[model samples]
Target: MLLAALFLLSACKTEPANQGFCGIIPKRLEAAMSYGTSLYLGSMPDQEFLREDQGRSLRQIPPLEVREDPMAVQAVTRGRCAFSIFEESFASEQKELQGLKSAQLLYGYPDSVVFRMYVNPAALRGEEARTRTLDFLDTLWSDEFQSKLEFYGLKPVPEGLRTQVRNDLPGFLTTASESE
Candidate 1:
């Protein structure tokens, strides 16, 4: 009985879904924390005036914490994304993003940031993934999408969705410039 119990305990581990990509854990965590804290902490500090927006957003969202487990990887319902309009943008073809399992902001330099939906190697069949990525990008960058988010008394798209998966989803505001 003692040996069995010990074995069970040893079998348990703690790490995140993308443990093999440990090198990225810090940067990803930093991005989520950096963006979330600023947005969450940016709420109006007035209680009386805020009462009018009760149904809209009476409370601020809590900051997100990164979870890492080694024993098992569960399907995550959320992702993180942080972008600034001040950054430069570039287009990323599918061939350039094969290792990416999700959509995200990739900063190659101070002014060279690409908003790309990367292939997960496992997200879907190769052709299906390519099609889905293009479709997702179109929907995300649509003017209607941004307007809807702003109409909801919410910040723009990236600031509106407060989920880790938000980072994995294509962002509407990060599209490449027409001149680029």
Candidate 2:
């Protein structure tokens, strides 16, 4: 009986989902000119946004090729594409990696890529696990982590967005937990 109870307690112990969650990392992409004569989009989100805005705010621009961000940078570095959309942080990092010297920022866009905290579905299975997961999610926004965002080529979530996410997180957490 003692051994069975110990086994049950051990099996019930919930560990924090440190590796199962993703931290929020806000990043924006910039349209950069390199060597090609035509424009291109590196990320799917940018392509989708441009497509949606084609008839409205971006009527003057034509449809462009869509490629992975790294491939877009490579194409520009290799002089295959004239311009490409690159995340601000990735642009700087890739320039150094590709030994690119002539890439120029053509236009700045609003924050379009913001990663949100996502806890593993398995972590929301029980009350203790849910609490631990929620606590872990909150720590992602701590000052220490926020301070390191720039170093990782990410921007801190703005206060407004932070508040919005904070307001919405509990509902999401509760829903996820209840669903389990």
Candidate 3:
């Protein structure tokens, strides 16, 4: 009886191990540029935003453009944006952006900001893993996570500034990366 109880206890205590890639966002101009671009292109009223808006409600306005630029990515949500870090010409502009501490100020707008990073999703057991990864991203965008980001140096972008930057995403990403 004692041995059976011990075995059951140990089995119940077993937990899954963390197995995934460990990525790093290099503190450089490229990262900053990518972040900025994402902020510009990913904000609400952007293409993706319009699509979601249309899907949810019939009165949404169509976006001016349907296709994203080949060189950029965006978030198009209230929480975050997607920016690319691997542009080829980003190495040359490092000198021009020396004093820009945060990507938020690079655009000369106080309310909007860009985010950059290297994310390693946990080792997924199957197709469901992808879904899990997206769920994890949702948590990152939660208000609780945003507060933590502010503590680290990133600032939350306001809705109005987000609209203004949506048109200049590619250039912003390229410039920021080069400056890095």
Candidate 4:
């Protein structure tokens, strides 16, 4: 039993380091999976440093717990890649990439599937905003969004936005802030 336990622990080692700030994602220093539903990354750079073949992960933070579901958190910056496609279209197509006007997307990985929803009490109000949010999420889960994720290498695409988790965004931000 002791030997079996040891083997199991060893077997749980994380994936080989391939995803980094300048690798799969342009902002690649390192992207990590956390105990909670969030993955944190850092070492942002300016646009001048951005190069080709680099991209960001789009994995949404998972839920920490049922109680953590309603807390809206801001977007976490993994790294600054001026070349990242997000930056390229950030202003021109912000609404197209984001599900909620109050919520934003990040570059993530395949193992950490992102199914996130955010509600901003200030910006998101009234029937119009609510309707937009629902429509955005629905469109996010559609084939188009999943394909977008696949291109960025964030896979195991979520079934839908019904799996919204609130604590993840906060958790990711905390990780990024503390590490800095």
Global lDDT scores for all candidate models: 0.28, 0.34, 0.28, 0.25
Tens-place lDDT per residue, model 4, 1-180, is: 111101111111222111111111122211211100111112233233232212323112111111111111122112110011132223333343243222233334534323333332222223343333333333433444444454444543344432342223322222222446
Worst 10 residues of 1 by lDDT: 2-11
Candidates 1 and 3, the one with greater TM-score: 3
Q: Model 3: residues >4 Å from true position, as ranges?
A: 1-24, 27-113, 116-125, 159-180
List TM-score per model, in order. Answer: 0.24, 0.34, 0.27, 0.28
How do the residues 1-180 of candidate 1 rate in per-residue lDDT, one tens digit apiece?
Answer: 111101111111232222111111222233433332333335323445335323322122221223333211221111111111111122222132222344443233323343333223222223433343334333343334433433322323343342344443443222233215
- Residue range 1-180, candidate 2, lDDT tens digits: 111101111111133122222111112311211101111122223455545544442122222233444544443333322223444455555543343222221222235543322222333334544454444444444444444455544566655555555455455455433656
TM-score top scorer: 2
- What is residue 150's positional error in candidate 4, in angstroms? 1.6
lDDT of 4 at 23: 11
- The prediction achieving the highest lDDT against the true structure is 2
Give the TM-score comparing model 1 with the true structure, all chains together.
Answer: 0.24
Candidate 4 Cα errors over 4 Å, as ranges: 1-107, 110-115, 120-123, 156-180
Q: What is the lDDT of residue 163 in candidate 1?
A: 39
Model 2 weakest lDDT span, ten residues long: 2-11
The runs of at least 3 residues in candidate 1 whose Cα sits more than 4 Å from the true structure, single-residue gaps closed, are 1-121, 157-180
List, residue by residue over 59-86, the lDDT tens digit for candidate 3: 1221111112331222111112111121
> Which runs in model 2 stand beyond 4 Å of their true positions?
1-112, 118-123, 176-180
Whichever of 3 and 4 has more TM-score, that candidate is 4
